[model samples]
Structure formats: C-alpha cells, structure tokens
Target chain A: MSVLAFPPPVESEAAETLRAEVRAFLADANAARTPLERAESWNGFDREFSRALGRRGWLGMTWPKEYGGHERSAFERYVVVEETLAAGAPVAAHWIADRQSGPTLLRHGTEAQKRAILPRIAAGECVFCIGMSEPDAGSDLAATRARAERQGDGSWKVNGTKLWTTYGHEADYMILFCRTSGTPADRHEGTSQLLVDMRMTSGVTVRPIHDLMGQHHFNEVHFEDAVLPPDALLGTEGQGWAQVMGELAHERSGPERFLSSIQLLIELIGALRGSESLAAQAAVGRLFAHLVTLRRMSRGVAALLEAGDDPTTHAAIVKDLGATFEQELPDIARSLVDEEPDLRSTSDFAAVLAYTMMAAPAFSLRGGTREILRGIIARQLGLR
Target chain B: MDDVSSIIFESAQRLLSDLSERVSAGRPMADCERADGWRQIEEMGLPFALMSEAQGGLGLSDAEAFELVRICGRNVVPWPLVDTMLANRFATQGGAAPAEGPIDTLGELTAEQKERAALARAMQMAGALDVILVMTISHVQERSQFGRPLAKFQAVQHSLAVLAGEVAAGQAAAEHAVARLARGGAAATLAIGIARARIGEACSKAAAIAHQLHGAIGYAREHRLHLYTTSLWRWRDEYGTQTWWTRQVGREVLAAGPDAFWPAVTGA
Candidate 1:
C-alpha cells in the first residue's frame, strides 16, 4: 500500500497545547544544560528532572489513569517523545521505564503489582533496567542461560549474568529474563521474566563497563541466587520470549532511534551556511533526502502503531534505514567541516560533531545490530 | 473536504477500477482512435469541470482536484486530463470559449516543423487532440564529452530529472487550478506554481533515468519508451522550467513569510 494512504496524524487541541508547554520547558532546559554537555543518547540520569516531568503527567502519558497514567493517545506521547529527543533533554532516567516497562506492566502485570509499582514508576520514584542480553547471548536472546528456579517457599531463585545492561547499576529493579524450565536446547520455550528488586536482592552485583567513549553508561550485572516472590513473575511463565519481543517493538521503533544525530546535523548545516563547495552542497542535499525518506518511513510505522497494528516488518525497515543514515551523518560531517572535532571544545559545533562521531557506532549495534536486523528483514521476506 | 471528498473518492475509484478492467481486456490505450478517446473523456465530463456553472461546469475546489490527480497518478491513466484542464482554465481565464475536445500540451520541440507536426500527429494518432503545447531548446545533435554523447553526462541526467519534476508539478497545479476556478474562487496561481515545480523535477528525473538506461538507442525511433520520456522532457520545460516556477513561488512565499507558505501552496 502507498504510504500516503495511511491516515494523517489527527490534530489534537490537547496535544497542541501540550506541545507548546513542552516547547517552553525545553527552551528553559536548553538554556540551562545545553544538552550538548550530556551524552549523545540524552544520558544525564536526573531523578529529580524525571519526577518533574512525571508531576506534569508527561512520563507515562499514554497509560491508563488508574495506573497513574493520563490515558493520552499514543500519537500524543509520540509528539512528546519526538520533541524531547529533538531538544536533547536529560530523559534517560525515565526513558526505558516509561517507554517499555510501564507499557509491559500495564499489559501483563497483576493487580497487586500494578498498585505497588505503576504509581511509583509514573511518579519517577523508581527506575528499571532491562536484563535480557547476556555475555554469550546478545542478539540471540533465546540462547539466554540465566536460570530462575522455583523455590519450595513459593519464591524463585534467580542466577544469571546480563551484559551491556544500560543504567543497571542505578536501577531499582531488573526485569530479569531467564530459563525457568526445560533445558538450554529448548531455546525460546521454558523461559520467563521475573522482576527482581535490585535493593533487596542478596547476591546481585553491577559493575560498570566503560565504552569506547569512556562513559560508564552500561554495565555487566550478575545475579547469584537472588530470591523473588511468586508475584514477581510478569505475565505467564514460559512466555518470556514472546513478551520480550513485544517489548522490543517499543524499544526498537522510536524517534530516539533516528533523531540522535539530528542535532549535530542541524549544527553542521548552520556552520556550512557560507560554504559553496559542490561536495558540501551534495552532502547536505543527500543527507536531507535520506532524512526525509527516513521520516516518511518512520512516520508510517508510527501511524500503524497508533492504529494498533503490529508493523514489525515496517519497524525493521525503519531501523535498517535509520541505522544507515545515522552511520552516514558523521562521515558527511567530517568531510564538510574543515576543523577537527573535539569533545572538549568550547564550540557547540565541535562538541556535537565529537559526540556524534563517538555515538554513531552504537546506533546500529544497540537495540539490535545491523546484520541481525537485516536477517530479521530477510526472514520477513521469507528468504530464510 | 471530508464528506464531499469521501463521495468523490468512492465514485472515482469505482470508475477507475472499471477503466482498468477495460484496459486489461486486450485493448491497449493507443489502439483507441482519437475521436473515441475524446468521446470517452467527454462522457466522463472531466473537462467541463474546469469552468463555472455560469460557463458550464460542476464547481469543485482545488483540494478536490488534487485528490483526483493523486487518484489518476496512482492508476497511471494515459488520458490528457492535466493538459486539457490547463487549456480549459487558460482559455476561460483569458475570456476565450473553453475548447470543445481534448486540448493537449506539448513540452518539447524538434528542429523542423515537419518533425514537430509528426509528433503532434502521433499524439493525434493515439487519441484526438484539439490543441498541442510545445517548448523549444537548443539542439545537441553531434556534441560529445569524454568520448560520448553530451546527453550521457551525469550532470545532464541530474538536470533532466529536475526538469521532469517541474513538469509533473505544473501539470498537477494546473489541474488543481481548473478545479478551483470551476468553484468560482480566485485562481489558485500559487498552488499551480508549486505543482509545476514538483512536476518539473519528477519529469526531468524520469527522462534522465530513461536516457541513461537507453544510451544512444534513446534517440532512435524504434525505442517506444522515448515517446513518453522525450515528451516528458519537452513538456516539463514547456509550461515553466523548475527555476522559473521556483523563483515565482519562492518570491510569493518569502513575501507571505514562512508560516503562510504552506497554506498558500496548499490552498488550505
């Protein structure tokens, strides 16, 4: 079907009002922190800042009001997310929790779990980390060796190591994905997710792993027989693979996936205003075209999501193309600019360029690698 | 826009589906005699929709026309809906009686009148045309660059794409203007300009791709694709070049400010 056939975004008076309010807040925040000081992924984890957003009912904007959400439309939440990403706000504190965990809990958590956690999560008093990737099992999540054995006392004992856990060290809890039944060869079957309290866990350790940019944004989390109540199991047992995959749709297809390098591009264009070189012009033109196409594709996916469609294949397409553009931005910037990009430079342009250069590699690797994404696309096309 | 559009779309879609069936049943569009093509369009009453009820038309808005163009583009109909609409609108605005039959517009000109006349005759051969529109450019018959035809240059190809885009945009705009004029609104000059710009770009791009793929064979008569692609090149440059419409719309938009540009171009 033609992309244009998709319903145009419905104009909302409430959304427009909220957008204006968000613009005002961003204008103030931009003046204060100048987000360029933060990491490329909007990495300042300010609990207080998150709480402020929560107070305004912006964090879990689309969740049910009974679960401490505003019950706003997904498109409204999309506007907020897009504007936030574009402004480069310090949203990392509530980003994962609000984006995926909140939605997942709403979909599958018990009444008790919802009453206890949803309000706290919406209020930004608690934060969560996804514990799916392991040292041996990265993109191949079905290969997870983490074990959660049922205890006689009606609790579960979890023993596992999850690698590349973003914000794991500071998280209040880890949504642990482990094999609860059957053998390793079972792969996708016999697995379940147990929400383990990071504070109460007896043998839980989080060790920071510095990245190539020397930022301790991710960690290696080890759990040794950490006990959790029976109620800690999210949704049904042995459905962890399905739940995680659903949660990934939220994680993978978002404005954050593509807009990370946009600020740098904007800054680069501002700097290139006077240059008349053919290469520079063509570079800008090519980047603009790619960006437009990406927006069209991404918007199509967003429209589908709003209409309550799965759009998994379309999301995969967006991620694949978005990754390509993200990787190309730095290369284009490097050739366009005459000066060397320095992270410590006082110049905003230099700092943005430096951040994008360091951050571009993770664009495809994080969430899912480019090769893995293409393999998924190939499968969707029935090539495998 | 909502209620009227839904009805128009529903009805037009049914008609287009019926047209598709007819085209698929061993009857190519070119096989239809010129008079037959004219009769078919006249029965559709699409051309008469350009003038007001006072001047004989069912008044429709520019937005409606845009929707119709999108529908037509999606189906790839070979009718001269765009060219006829432009001719009718220009005639009505110029206080000339709207042309009775299919009035086609030409975009390119060959050196000799005979060649031009032959091209016109071919268009007539395919279907009846009341009028033909044409544009002229300097000939590059024997020029070579880097031991090849100058037309084979990458830069030349890019320029052609831009030209095609301009033509497509104009054709779309002119159709839109006709619809708006039928509704007795002030002429949608700006919308027409925007469409012209976009059409020019699309046409040029299509032409360049065709030429690049065809190489020397593109200019040869035996290659049927040239009939469409070359016409696109000629027609794209005829109504208004990309630069011309771009400057016209750009100046209007600048005068109106950034906020008003969209509304002006969209006729919202």
Candidate 2:
C-alpha cells in the first residue's frame, strides 16, 4: 500500500510581516461585526470589506503586479488567508475569485481574458463562481449533459443547468464546464471550460437556493442558449476535466477547509474563560491541536502547489481530515458546557453554538463530500 | 531525504531491520539489553547528529532527527533512544559534557527538551500506527467468521477507516512538530504542545481500534502486534500526557485574553 506523504513544514519569513498587516487591518474592519456575523465564517460577504482588502493589495498577493496584484510570495498569500479565516473576515465576495478562479485563469486563461478579468478580480470588483455540477451531475461531473454547439463565426451556443453554484446569483462570471465534441462514452475527453460573463450574457437566469440555515449563499443557474465568443474557452477545448482537477486541488486544501467553525471555538473559549472546567480546557486544547495539525498539512499542500506539484491525493486527505474536525467542533463545545444552544440568546456562546450546530452539517458536503473524498484517498492507498 | 539523512537513515534502517528480525524470532523487549542497541546506535553517532560541529557532532537538521525517530518507531526499537538523543542535545546546550555511552535516562528536562522529546514520541506513535494498521488490514482480509472473510463485513471496513483517520492525524501532528522544530521559531513550543496532545489522543483511538480489529490474537504475548501497541501505550504517557499538554495550552491561551484567542489558535 502506498502511504501518504506530506512535504516538510515551511515557516515563511513573510509570515510575521504579512500577519501583522492583516491583523491590523482586521482589527478595525471587524470592530463592529457581531459574533453571529463572524459565525457566518467565510460565507459572510461584505463588499466594502472585500474592496478594502483589494485596496490593500491582499486579494491576489501571489499574482503579478501588472495584473493589479501585490507580486507577493505564496507563503505571504497563505498568511493573509490563514489570518483572514481565523478572524472570520467577510471575504466571501472575493473568496472564490481569489482562491481558485484567479489562479486557474492565470494558469490557463487566454492573454486577452487575463488582461480583462484579472485586474477586476484583483480589485475585488469581479466575483466568480464554478459551473461544474449540473442537475444530473455532482461528484461524477463527467455525467454532465450540458452541451456547447459551435455556431457561425466560430462562436458557441451553450445550454445547461448548473446547481449549487455558490454566490452565482451575485457573481460577475462563471468558469463553465460543458461537453464540446464527444459522446457521454468519451467521459472526460470532450469537456471544455468556458468563461461565461454573467453581466453581459443573455438568456441566463440565476435563482437563489437558500441553505438549511436560511442563507441565500447558493444558486441554481440556467443557461438557455447562452452565446459565447471563441475566446471564452479556457485552456484548450476538451481539456476542462484535467483543468478542473487542478483547480480542485486549490479549492480543497485552503485554511478555509478547517477554519469554518473558528467563531464557535473562539466563543467557547470566551465563555469558559477563567472557569474551573478542566474538561472544557482539555477539549479546547485538543481542538486546537487538531486545527494546528490540519493547518500544517494544508500549508504543506500550499507549498506543493507553489512548487508546481500535482497534489491531488494530498489535497483530498487535507479536506477529509479538515471536514472531520470542522464537523466535530460544535459537538466538542457542547460536551464541555451545560447550556442550551440558542441563536437569539443573550449569551454569545449559546448563539454561536446554535449557529455552528446548524452549519456543521454542511462542512463535509460543501467543498467535496466526505464520501467522494474518501474514495479518492482509498484509491490513493491502492485500495481500488 | 538529504545526503546526510539518507546515508544515516539507510545504515540505521539496515541495522534496525536486523534487530527487528531477531526480535521477531521470539525475543521480547525485556530480553533485549538497552545498552546493546544503544551501543550500535551510538557507534552510528545518531544521538549526536543534532549537536554542533564544535561539540563533535554532524550538526544535522531537526528534520533528519525526526526521520531518525520515525525509523526507530517503525522498527519497534526497545531502547529509550529518543530520550537519550534529546539528553545529548540538552547536555551539550547546558555546557555539560555530552555522554559518550548510551544515556540511561535524563535527569530534569527543560521545557524545550520536554516538548522536543514529546514530538519524537509522537513520531514513534505514528510509526507504531503504520505497523498496527498494516497488520490489522491483513488480518481482517485473511481471518474468517460467519462463513466469510472478516474483510467482507461492512462494519469491519468502517472500523478500519476510522483507524486510518487516527493514523493520518497522528502523522500530520508529528510532521507539524517536526516543521516547527526545524524552524526554531517562537511558536515551536505551542506546536510541540499540540503535537503531543493530538498524537497522544490518536494513540488511544488507534490502539483500541487496532486491538479490536485484530481480535484476541493481538493481545497475545507471542503475537508481534503487541510490540507496536505496547510501545504506543508507553510513548503516549511519556514526555507529556495528553491531559498535561492540553492543560498547558489551555492556560496559556486563556491568559492571553479572548481577543487573542484567534491569533493564538493561528499562532500568528
């Protein structure tokens, strides 16, 4: 059996410098946000706060300066992400764009597309969404029946429905993956990624899909004969399957994978502050231990990505372990204290507890489900 | 993975593999003199690998030392080699003469030494976890019950999955500690605390699941599985217990105030 290997740990020289800058900015930016607002985690969207981060050049720290980025190292960008997630920064507006979309575009986008979209994304004015999962396809994305037919003048007509598109209703663009040239038997071969401009595209509809927590962060997008120019295709035609796999590596291994419940954890620590609950103290310590381990692994994956390695299996492990920790935080908090969870309670602890209990169930399902992740890991172990 | 570490690890692995074969032939840990193994390790100069050149050592990196510890764990080495390695570093740093022979046991330990040793122990636990998991997976595939191989049972597969998770967590925790020690930064102590506590916790879950998966045979004195699990039990309590490290982390964070909680968690 092949064992998993994480690259040796890395401590960047830029960690402290960038950490201080991010911390100083977060202190004032988060001054008025409530515990519940912070409880929203990265799902908390604030346009002004995102714009402010862009102004400070934190949005695309690893990209080139000519693209309106700060031209910082990946480690510096990692520091920004870790600090932002820990403080529960309202980064959802630019989160998808900055995390995976921008990176993917930089890797495979046409030069013209990069010039037009990269600067706006870096400025936090352009938000992006993934358009991979369709009504008939989720984890098994190859089952995608969405078709793009080539039209006159080398353009294309796209028709399909994408589901569970996070921030799609508010997004400015989508990296749409659809079938271009082969039958379903071709599976991964016929797929291609198209850059769909949400603002300018006609016959496209976005319907909000409120989560169980009553939050409208997800959407269902319908592309009814949406017309796109030839330059819209990312990378090459029939290479979207490979391209998306590379993008998934970025999506799966970020600090956001594990820090989704930091607000609950912070609130628990505050509630038990100076109390004589050894169990609570021990629980908090254990949670931090798991978190620290996950962060190291996540950072190791970041290093691998920065080194231009394909860490597909490594990223899967990080996400699976991260999901376990995120889903378990609320339960551990509950076992340590003896209070009823109440979202409206005067106690911030109870409110966070209530909120986290509702949100924890989605931690495993959101990025990539636990089942899909485990299958990948099992295959990596040579079990399949 | 460097030239120095690769050369040292290769030689040590060969020597340790020979020792493992001897132990596998039927000798228990109690029968093996601690000094005999220490002499071989000392001759290889592994205990002094992390000391400075002026102190007569190769002055290798912490990552090399960590790999050595993991190798020792994988072989189920009976001696307290990790403790002695740390003693050499501590003694040299304290301006005391480095011990020439196998160190019996350390006297009092500094906080840094304790944390470092705890990380080594965690790596040992990770190594033990690998052996235990491999053994159990094989056992479940071969052993049969209810007219079918044990591996055919859904419950057994799920149990094995949980054990794998614990193993993964332990390795992650130990690697994090290794990285922290290599950096030698201010956050090293906290990283060590987390490693000891998290790996210690994983050891418990791993041990139970391993024993359960192996059935009654795992507990037998004659079975090789006990060598790994028993060492895990000993290592989990040594250096620092999960409760001790946890309490230390808790007290430190709480004293920093609620506002510092996030920063403390992130080690920023």
Candidate 3:
C-alpha cells in the first residue's frame, strides 16, 4: 500500500497541553547537562530521571490506570517522547519497558505475569530488555537457535545464546524468543517466548559488547541450561513468531526514530545563528522539510497503534525514512559549519558534531538494517 | 483526510474517468477546449472552491479545496484548474471579483501570488508523482526480464522501494503545506517554501528512477508517461525554479534563527 493510504494525524488540544508540560519539565531537568552529554541522545541512562518521569505520570501513559498508568491518549505519550528526545534527556532506564515490554505483557502475557510486572514498569522501577537477536539470527530471526524445552514436571529448561540484547545486565526480565519443538530450519513453526527473570533464573550470563564508540549499549546473554518455573512461558506455544512481530511493530514506531538527532540540528542552528550563506539556509530548510514530513508519517503510525491496528508495515517505512534523515544529519552539519569534529572540543558544535559523526552509522544498522527494511516495504508493495 | 475532501476526490475521479475514455477515443483533451468538462467542473464551482462561503464558493480549507487540483494532476487533465482555483481565491482576497474562467499559466505574479502559486504547483506535482508510482509498480510487476518479472529481482525491488519513499515524502510535504496554506502567516510562508523545495527534489529523483525502470516506452511521446513527467518538469520551474526556492527557504530559515525554527515546524 502507498504510504499516503495512512490516516492523517490530528493531535488533540490535551496532547499539546501535555507537550508544553513536557517541554517545561525538560528545560529544568536538562539544564545542568553538558552538550556532549546531551549528545548521547536516547542511550543516556539516568535511573533518577526515569523515576522522576514516573512521578509526573509520563511512564506508561497509554495503559490501564489499574496498572499504575495515567491512561492518556497515545498522542499525549507521543508528545512527551518527542519533547524528551528533543531535549536529549537521559531516558534509557525506562525506555524499553515503557515503549514495548509493558504493552507486550498486556497483550500476550499470562494474567499473573501482567500483575507481577506491569506496575513496576509503570513506576519506572523495572527496566526491560529484548531477547530476540541471536548471534546466528540477526536479520533471519526465524533462524533463532536459542531453545527452551518443557520438563516432565511442567518446568522449563532454557539453553543457547542471545546477541545484542541492549542493557540486558541491567534489565529485570527478558521476553525471550526461542525454539521449543523444531530444528533451526523450521523458520516459524516451533518458536515460543519465555519471560526470563534475570534475578530468578539460573545460569544466565550477560557478556558486554562495546561498540566502536566504546559505549556499552549492547550485550550477549547466554542461557547455559537455565531453569525457569512453569509460569515463564509468555504467550502460547508456537506463537513466538507472531508475538515478536507485535513487539516489533511497537519497537519501530515512535518519535524517537526521527528526533534522536534534534540536538545536532539545534547546535547547527545555534552555530550558524546569523549566517546569510545560501547553502546554510537552504540546507537547514531542507532538513526541516524532511523533519516535518517524517513527523507526520510517524504520528500517523502512532494513531494506527492507538486505534489497536497492527502498524508493522507503516512503522517499517517510518523507521527506514527516519533512519535516512538521521544518518545524513552529521554530514549536513559538517557542510554548514566550519567546525572540526572533536568529542572533547570546547565548542559545543564541534563536540556534538563529533559525537554524531561517530554514532550516525548505527542509525540504519540498528533495530532492523536498511536492506531488510526495504525488503519489507517491497513485499508490502506486492513486489514479492 | 476529511469527509469533504474524500467526496470531492471521488467526484473528480468519476468525472475524469469518463472524460479520459473520450480522450482515448481520439478527442484528446489537449486538442479541443473541452468546454463540456469545463462546464461540469464550473458547476461544481471548483474555480472559486478556495473562497469563503460569502464569496459564492464552498468554504473549504486550502488542502480540502485543492483535492480537485490534485485529481486533475493525477489524470493529467488538460486544463488550468490549479491556476484558476488559486487566482480566484487570491482575487477575492485582493477585493477583485473571482475570475469567471481558467486563468493564465504565464504571467508575472505578485509576492503573495508567487508563494501561493508555488504551493499549487507542488500539490499538482505531488499527485503526478503518485500516479507515476502506480503505473511503474504495475509495469515492473508485469514486464519480464531474464524470464522473470522485473520486480522479482532484488535490484528492481530496492529501486522501486526508493521510488515509493520519494513519492510518499513528496506527497506528505505538499499535504503539510496545503493544510497550512489557508492560515497564511510566517509559518505558512516557511511551509510553502519547504514544500516547493522538497517536492522539487522528490520529483527529480522519482522521475529518474521511474523512467529508468520503464525503459524505452516511458520515454516515448505516444506513451501516457510523458503526460505526467512533462507536467512534473514544467511545474517545478514555472512558479520558481527549484534552485531559487531552495535558496529562499535557506535564507529565510536562517533569518528566523534556531530558537524560532523548531516551534515554527511544530506550530507551538
């Protein structure tokens, strides 16, 4: 389907009011942080900041109030997310739980699991990590080699490894995607999701994987014959493939996909505050054009998510388009301003540029690679 | 987007489908004045659709009123509907009576006229790009190469995906500006500038990929492809050359400065 087939987004007045509230909160919260620190973007972890957001009822903004949520519209939650991302607030501590895990539990989790985990997530006291990507199964997720089998007594034994599990060591639980009944070649037939409680489960090991920027944003978790109770199964047997898709639809659609580099754009504008160069103005204006359009598309997908429709196809398009915008940002900055990129540079422009230049490559590589995303879009277009 | 827009959209589609059949039977819309189509259109009062209700027109928002213009673009209708709608609305604003018939595509425009015309051109180009994508997707799916449909190849699939992105983004930029056009402020000015600039870029890139994929048939005058590509080429240059608007947007945005920039985008 054409992307124009998406419904036009209309934000309520209450959502805008919530936006102003978020902007005010961020101005105070982010005041003391350095530009270089702000350049850390979404991965800046501050547990206190996460808890503060919970106090403001920004966490779990769309879930049931009975689950410690405020039950606001998704647009309001969207407003809060865009503002925090624009401000470069340290939001990683509660990002995963707030964005996907709580919603996943509310969808496919056992009633007991939702009761046990949902409130703590809403309170920002719990952090969640995804356990989908294994070393052998990055893009070909169905090739997942991780296994969890039933014991005769109704317990479970988990084995194999999960790669690139972001913040796994720090997370309270992992919604693991693994094989239960079939061999590795059985792409979709035998997979199931199990909620691995890092504290409660035995034989779980998280080995850090430092990226090229020397950041510890990802890890590999190994389950060496890990033991779990009967209640660990997340959804139903043989439904992990479908359940993981639901999680990914949530994973991909959000203001974070596009607003991750607002700080870079801000600093670029600040540095060239009064320049009359045609190149600078046209370049910045072009960036704004892309931003405005991307925001509209992303908001449309948010509306789809809010209305309880599966937004996988539209979300992939947004994520791909947003990644292109983000990946191209540092080059635009370098062209407009004459600053050399340096992480320790005294100039905020230089430092932020340096940070973005290093981090920009991951924009297209993470979540899902660009090639993979385009294939999804192609299939949606009926090319497959 | 809204009910009125969809209503006009469906009406336009039906009207154009009937007229296109007549053209296919050799009464090409370009050859004759096609006064019958014009009369039907005038009955719908599309010429003054942008004017407020007091001005003897449907009081539609700029984006809503432009649905007729977009449909005209999609069908490559041989009329100056875009220019007429824009001129009529502008005439009412200037204390002149709304124009009775089609307006000139060539004439020096006032400052405000130029901005509105640029937005109108972008809207038309957006629609043309959409239809071109539909045509190209069908061609790639049906045409064979090396014993397989072209779309079955990974290379063609990736290229078409890129084309779809451009089409989607171009339409979005135009829709955003059209929604802001009726407001008519500094924000509107910036929005129009963005649409004109970005859609021009999308047009260039999208046309290239689409034409390449269609190969020889797309380049021939006999094919329906020229009907849209020619319009895309002409519209991007008519109101303001893409180069001129790109620079204007650049200078104006810098003049607005960074602090005012993001707020302008979000309209907060």
Candidate 4:
C-alpha cells in the first residue's frame, strides 16, 4: 500500500453553504482590518471576533450538542475553517480552544469539567493555551520537567515552566502537560495533562517573549506552586503522551497549515496578473495546484478523523507537505515579483511578502519541526 | 463498485508484475512481445474501462479508468495503454473506430485530447513514482553499509521519507485531477493543469532521490529502477512539461485577478 492515501475530500451542499456563510461573514467582519492584520489570520487575536463566529455557530462545530457544540460533520467544520483562514480572518483568540482544547476535553475531560469548560469554549467566551514546550524541552516533548506533584488533600501542585506558549497571557485556561508521578528519566512515563485555569490559579505568571519579527504573541508561562483540584487531570493519569499525540492530528493537518502563506499567493497573483512571463505564471499556477492537493489530503484526514479513524500518519503528511509549500512560496513569489520585502511599504503585496518571509521559518519549526515530522513518516513507513 | 475496482486493479497488477520484466531490462518490447501483453489485457476487458455501456465497454468511471492507466504505468507496460484508453474513449465517444492493434506512438491528437492524455501521463507518472519509492525502500532495507542497513541510518530514513512524501503527493495530485476532471465543470481544466504540473515536479524530485538512495547500482540501465525513472523523465515532458501546465493554469488565474482568484480556486 502507498504510505499516503488520503481519501478524496467530501463536499456537500451543507458544507458549501457554510463556506458561503463564512465568506459573507468575513467580507463584513474583515472590512476594517488591514491586509497585514488579515494576513495574521489564525494568529490575529480578537476576542470579540471569535465570539462573533461563536454566536454564528462556527465554533466547536463537530462536538456533541450536549456540550454546546453544533454536532455538525467534520467536513462542514473544515469548510468554515478553510474559508476563515483563506480570507485571513482574525481567529487567534479561540483557535487553540476551538481546535484542540474542546475536542480533548470531549475525549478525556470529566463530566463536570466538560460541562464547565466546553460550553464556554463553544461560546468563544473562553481562551486556551498549550503548555507543552518548556525551557529544556521543545522537540523532545517527553523530556518535560514540569512536575505536577499530588497533594495530600488529593489536590495537585504544578511547578515548572512552559516556553513558546502562544497567547499565554490572554488565555483563560491552559492544557498543562506535566510530570505527574515520575522523574524526567521516565521519558513518556509518569506524565499527565492538567486543565489549568489561568484566572483560577494563583501562582501562574505569563511573560511575553518577543519573536524574531518583534511579535509578542508567544509567551513563557511559569507555574510556580500553582495548585489544582483533583478533577483538573485530563484523561487517565500517566497517559499524557498518548493524549498529546492524538491532539497533534488535530493540530498538524488543517487549512491553516497550508493557508498560512495564502496571503502571499494572493498578492503574487495581483502582482503578476498582466505579466507575460511564463515562468512566473507556471510557478504561481503550480502553487495553486499544490494547494488543491494538500487541501484534499487535509480534508481526507478530517473525514477520517470524523469517522473515528486514526489519521495521524495522513495528518503528518499534510502538515509536512503543506509547510514545504508554504515556506517555498515566499521565495517563489520574490523571484516572480520585483518588489523587496517591505513591511511598511504602501504596496499590499510588499507588506504581505515582508511578514511571510520572516514568518516562513516558523511554518516548519512550529507545531513540529521538519526533522521530527519526517521521522514520524519514516516510522509509519516501517523504517523504524 | 469498490470490489469491481479492486478486481480490475488486482488483475492488472498480476499481469503487469510479470509483463514489467520485458521492459525492466531497459529495452522496448518487440512487436510480438507487445502483442502478447496487449492480447492478455484485451481478453480481460481493460481497454474498455472508460467507455459507456452503450459502447459495449466495461462502463467504468473515469476515476476507475484512470486508475487502470495508473496500474499500466506502475508495471512500466512498454506498450500504449494510456493512448489506447484515451483513443478508444474519445473515438467511441465521437462515434469512430477504436485503434485496432497495440499502439506504440500516438496519432494526431486534439488540444482537449492532449489535455486528457496529459492527465493520463500524470497518473502514470504517479504510479511509476510509487513503484520507485517501493524499490528504493527495498534497496535501503536490504542493502547495508557501515555494518548496518541504510534504513537504520537517520539520514537515509529522512531521504526515503521525503521520497515517500513526494510519491504520495504525486498520487494525490493525479487522483484529485481525476476527481475534478471527471465531474467536468469550470474547474476541470485548471484541475488537470494543476495536477499535471505538480505531478511533473514530483516525478523530478522523487526520481532524483530514488536514484541517489540507490547509489551507483541505480545508475545501471539494466537495473529495474531505469524502467520507472526513465518513464517519469519522458512522461513528465510528454504532453506538457511542469512549466507548460503551470503557465497554462497560471495565466488563467492571473487574468482572473486577485479579487476573483480565491473564488475561482474554490469554485464557489
């Protein structure tokens, strides 16, 4: 069998209608936002905008209705997401919460925990951050040292730090993956995921870590003696590794993975519209070609995920392939267009180019690095 | 329906697994040899894959027909299944005679015929790449260096992973093109262009890596690698090179302008 066989994307009138609905919303919602701001898209934080989508029933779409979700198909949710990202709507405020937190809670959260958090998440009134990467552990995620020791009263105290926590400062909650019972030498053992409410926790401090682009979204979230109730644990204790792995399929394959650099492609088309260069035309055309294939693969993953199949391998391929296309785009755009990367330029193309060029590195680096992803694929191929 | 598809795929696979050896030695099948392979398939009713029931054909879906073409490509069938399928499909559709014998070279083709042929080539290349990936994996797994198999090495594993990814991408591209082109709408033309262009790129990247991983042995013309690699090198440039399809679709997208670009892409 081929190592990658993504089922063809499923399209329905319902999904297409949702797509149109999302586009109509974006046209009005993104009217005042600058192109540069829209370019940020999923990373462009706007609580009000996230709630607007929530009220429209665009958030927590695939979850069960009892949890305040719309109980829609994954394909329908996928259409809404791709439209949002393709139009570059500001989705950062509720991205993590809607994408992973709610689903993780559905799968692993206790009844009370699900009742308390899922409704708020579905309403887009709550925000969540991932507490995975730490000071000494980025790619070696199992090397996590952040320990959440059990207390005598059956409570838990979390003491460690999580680095590169996106939107940590603004988050109302954080899914804290930490060592629950064992040492760092235990590798993936003795680890558990905790639901840490940022407001409810007293010892948590979120410090801004300016990115290379002088952005302040990523933060260092410190848990100094942060205590949690016994119910804070997500899923079975000591099963953090498996749960996190499941969450990754959600994170790695999505519209945003491929659509992150879409603004540049839009700008490239605008710049190259009337050009007589076949080289430019073909290069630009090939990008769209790659986009469609990646989109199919991603949608296939979504379908598999909805059907309760493990799409981890397929998801990895989408992320890897999508990131490659996204990162290569800026250079291809630069070659086709004469404009330099200028963030402050009056030209929209140049401004989009400037941000995308700088942001390109993170395309492969974030979520999972190039090497790690390839390794996962290799393992799937039975090389390991 | 799926069972019928699989039956077609399996029979093709069983026949091609043996027939591929004729070309694996880096030589075209002689007329007699080609005839034998063609006769075997003719008996099995594969050439009728794309025709409708009224045409006395198997009435397979376009996706299924293209998949048969893909199987032909996988075995490096040294004859003309693609040309025959297209010729017969278009001929019977237009109420003409299907080609009588095993086709080696194509006759005059229309621009639309050419595009369909390109889609066929795209799937063929995808199939050939899939074979190359399997061959490369086998090579790395069984062949050893520095007291361990190449598959045991991280560098080799990573390279093979990239090759596998390319192979998958090419397959997905061809399949995506088939899905859209079968539907036959405004997006069909652009879909083929995109798929063909992307598949050509995949053929290049994957063939090169498959060769690199095989080292000096893969360079041998007698090596079975040549069958798949050479086909990719030739097929990618058949109806159109990567850039040809790219420019064709790109110009259309450009003329559509930035505002209409995304809508055209999604076909919404």
Worst 10-residue lDDT window for candidate 3 chain A reads A1-10
Ten-residue stretch with the least lDDT total in model 2 chain B: B24-33
Tens digits of per-residue lDDT, candidate 3, A286-329, equal 88778888888788898898898878778887888899899899
For DockQ, the strongest prediction is 4
Which candidate order results from sorting by DockQ in descending order? 4, 3, 2, 1
lDDT of 4 by residue, B1-268 (tens): 4997888789888987787766657666687877788898788776766678789777677777888888888887766777777778788888987777655666788777887888899988878888898899899999999999999999998998888888888888888888888567556777888888788888999999999999999998879898789889999988877778888887888888889878876771
Q: Model 2 compared with the native: what TM-score? A: 0.89
Runs of candidate 3 with Cα error greater than 4 angstroms are A1-3, B1-8, B18-61, B91-101, B106-108
Winner by DockQ between candidate 4 and candidate 1: 4
Candidate 4 DockQ category?
medium
What's the lDDT for all of these models? Answer: 0.63, 0.82, 0.83, 0.86
After superposition, the stretches of candidate 4 with alpha carbons farther than 4 Å from their true spots are: B2-5, B22-24, B27-35, B47-56
TM-score of 4: 0.97
Per-residue lDDT of B209 in model 1: 47
Candidate 1: where are CA atoms >4 Å away?
Answer: A1-5, A274-303, A371-384, B1-35, B47-64, B77-80, B86-97, B100-268
TM-score of each: 0.72, 0.89, 0.94, 0.97
lDDT of 3 by residue, B100-182 (tens): 66887536678788887888788788889988899899999999989999999999988888888888878877887877776
The TM-score that candidate 1 achieves is: 0.72
Evaluated on CA atoms against the true complex, candidate 2 attains a DockQ of: 0.46
Show model 2 residue runs off by greater than 4 Å.
Answer: B1-5, B25-63, B83-116, B133-165, B178-188, B208-222
Ranking by lDDT: 4, 3, 2, 1
lDDT of 3 at A27: 83
The Cα error of candidate 1 at residue B253, in Å, is: 13
Better of 1 and 3 by DockQ: 3
